[model samples]
Target chain A: MSTSTEKEMWVTKLRKGWQKNLPVEKLLPDTQPAYVASWIYLFGVATLASLGLIIATGLWLSFEGASWYHGSNVGHFVNSLHFWSVQFFFVFMVVHLWGKFWMAAWRGRRMLTWITGALAFVGSIATAFTGYLVQSNFDSQWISYEAKDGFNSVGIGSRFTVTNFGQMLLLHVAFLPVIIGIITLIHVLLVRAKGVVPPIDAFNKELGERK
Target chain B: MGIFDHFMNLRAVYIHLGWFQISITNLIVVLGMLVLFGLALFLPFPGNKKKGQK
Candidate 1:
């Protein structure tokens, strides 16, 4: 009987703490309306969607064994999907980056968002490089040979071998994904924390009126 | 040995239809580009936001 009472008391305390922590009303207070300017904001969404497709197709390719992909018709189609996904991914990502740059979207209290995004971009490029190396084709061979000299000159060559299939595949498929994923998560959190940056003209107007 | 034989066969076929294979690859790439262009038309691109709404 005593143990049952103790358990009930503990459960009550835990429930109270969880309720206090959630305080959804406090978190979702009314703020400035979200600016959904035309369809341009969709570029970020499109890039994310392309990344989703890439991950799905990449999983499929991995399951089939990388070697099986080059010879079989289905494998070739999957390879095409992966290639096209990368191409679209880069195109949308570039547009998203340029869009953020021109808007000076780093303004307000969201500098962390901007910085995290920049880091993610760097991570994505590294991931792409590893991907190129893992292709195991003439392109991969050529890029590996050419890139080795450049990497060697920078002293990072000792850490990452462009010619090593095992290392490159692991980096491309596992390690870089984790890094980029973490950066993306942090970036989204910062964006939600600060909300969207206001329009530049509004900023200019506020400054002008103050003057 | 199994994978090597498959690749050798693929190479043999590709060698015989060299130009055709290349053209098909180019066509696929072009189709991919076209798909991207179509998406660009529908998707938000970031610069079209209104100027003064903060």
Candidate 2:
């Protein structure tokens, strides 16, 4: 392994990155602090699980296309599951965000983690908005008309019209999902790179500064 | 008591409390949001953070 002050090399940088930021013991910890048994700490994992369900049901929906989903009983069941999963994702993620914000989770060189998490929350809103616009129903049409004025007021409607079925459908299934996926990926990586932030009072324990 | 003859004509499910009435669906949504808010405020976190016992 290259020392911290060693001369630069691409391969050495990769080795140093893992050594300094993500040692295997920290990256995949088997034993969590006893304090980790609480429910709120699991919100991140809950949201992740909900996202997995959402994507799984979504792929099933995309495969069946709009006809089956709108017409068939089984498709409706899967759609309902997808809807509930999205609701769970938001509930868990928002609560998690609220918990982190109150805790000032940015402490301990974790600003990037907080930023990525916040961006993911915002990206989720856009993804959901496109999702509603692409629903292919009277409700969606009404929502598109209602939402267009707000987008126009912000000068974004001309570029991304909610009424454009083709554009909105593509955005919902492709663009927004991709953006959300990237943000979520970065957020998780940041959390892994910086080990879970301990409770403030735990700082008084044998916790040394992160190296 | 309401007439049983009109039972099949009923579509609106109402919960009556003295002077006020609300639909079951609206009640569920409102109560659900309140419950969610309460959970958000009081959910137990690691380190007993909710009670400052850490």
Candidate 3:
């Protein structure tokens, strides 16, 4: 009974500290509202949705057994879903990148957010490369040989083997996802912390012009 | 590395030349692009602002 009471007391203390550090008031934005946007703004959300589909389809494919995926109808459908997910992933990523570029979103203490996202984009390419190799199909074999030369030329062949199924699978399924997920979390946190930048005119106009 | 080795290495090019291979490759590429498009709906990349005005 005493031990349980002490545990409860510790929990209460932890809760109090959390409340003090992250009050609702502190979390609220001090700046402009975030809903301002055109239809293009929806692209980012679409990208995330596609990623969800990819993960779902990938899980289904993973359960089908490797050899089954190559010849079975159910496996084919799952593979199709995974394939389409990847296609949409790149499209959404490109659109989102282009949108961000046009917005000059790196300004006003938000530069690190932009840089981390750019790095995530680079990491995504690596993830995609591994995904291609893990297919274990004819194309996989052919691409592996072709890609090896490029990798070797860059001196990365010593450490990163494209033909290694175990390594590629682990990296694609585990390592890359963790990195991508963490970067995405950090990106979202930074956005929430900084709040959205107001319209350029809001900051650029003279004092007399201010409404 | 003689011309023969180069030719042997390029044997994969013949594989690409096959209609079946070409179709499969195109299918994969198209599907990949489609997936990227679908994803764009959700995880939008934040954009940069216009130049010189920030």
Candidate 4:
């Protein structure tokens, strides 16, 4: 018999919370609404795929070390792949954002989803900036030289230290990625929980009639 | 790999319009993205038919 003062275990409470907020069916639905058949929806998945590739290539580069990537031909190829993956990620993410904006994806109490996505974009920019700062190339040195003044003007240069390769490397490889990952995860979970926003035409008869 | 080297070594071509300027590579990439976005809007997605139809 449990005492009246007995407190629930934190693990049990956390499990219950997850179950309440995100059930298995909601988290992994087999079917989507008919309106999900648009090609614009594909860009979000493309962005995810590119992000996966970027992480994979980045991991490979990290394992290979700076000397390998800087000196070896295979390392250069891997580095190139990482770079291209980033390019694709940005393109796909931007296209997805634009498509969602045009469709008014924030409708139906999904403002938090939109906010998370916007935050993820901002976080990605920081991540990319740090990445450029850590490249150890002439371009990276030039970029850092130009960027230091901007950071100093904002009174963050003393702390952020754009000129410090080690600090920038840690931020790029570790900190910013984690922040972006958290934001992206939240955005995706919100999408799953709230369901994709229906087309604007679903509400407006005149818009529906135009199609 | 040699082909990649050749491509990488190729000089970037730039377009100039008054004060505006951009590399051909950047221009192609941007134009390609726009075309893809347009096509995505217009293309007929498979299985998008009415529920009663095949």
Top-DockQ structure, candidate number: 4
Which 10 successive residues of model 3 chain A have the least lDDT summed?
A30-39
TM-scores of the models, in the given order? 0.68, 0.77, 0.67, 0.88
Q: What is the DockQ of candidate 1?
A: 0.10
| Pairs that collide, model 4 | none
True contacts kept of each: 0.14, 0.14, 0.03, 0.48
Best by lDDT: 4
Ranking by TM-score: 4, 2, 1, 3
Runs with alpha carbons beyond 4 Å of true place in candidate 1: A1-34, A203-211, B1-54
For candidate 1, give the docking quality class from DockQ.
incorrect
Off by over 4 Å in 2: A1-7, A204-211, B1-54
List-wise, what DockQ does each model earn?
0.10, 0.14, 0.06, 0.54
Report residue A97 deviation for candidate 3 (angstroms): 0.8
lDDT of 4 at A198: 89
DockQ ranking of the models: 4, 2, 1, 3
TM-score for candidate 1: 0.68
Query: Runs in model 4 with CA error above 4 Å?
Result: A1-13, A203-211, B49-54
Report the C-alpha lDDT of model 4 over B1-54, residue by residue, as the tens digit. 335778866887889999999999888778878887888889988876555422
- What is the CA-based DockQ of model 2? 0.14
Select the stronger candidate by lDDT from 1 and 3.
1
**Cα RMSD over interface residues, candidate 2:** 8.2
Specify the CAPRI tier of model 2. Answer: incorrect
Model 3 compared with the native: what TM-score? 0.67
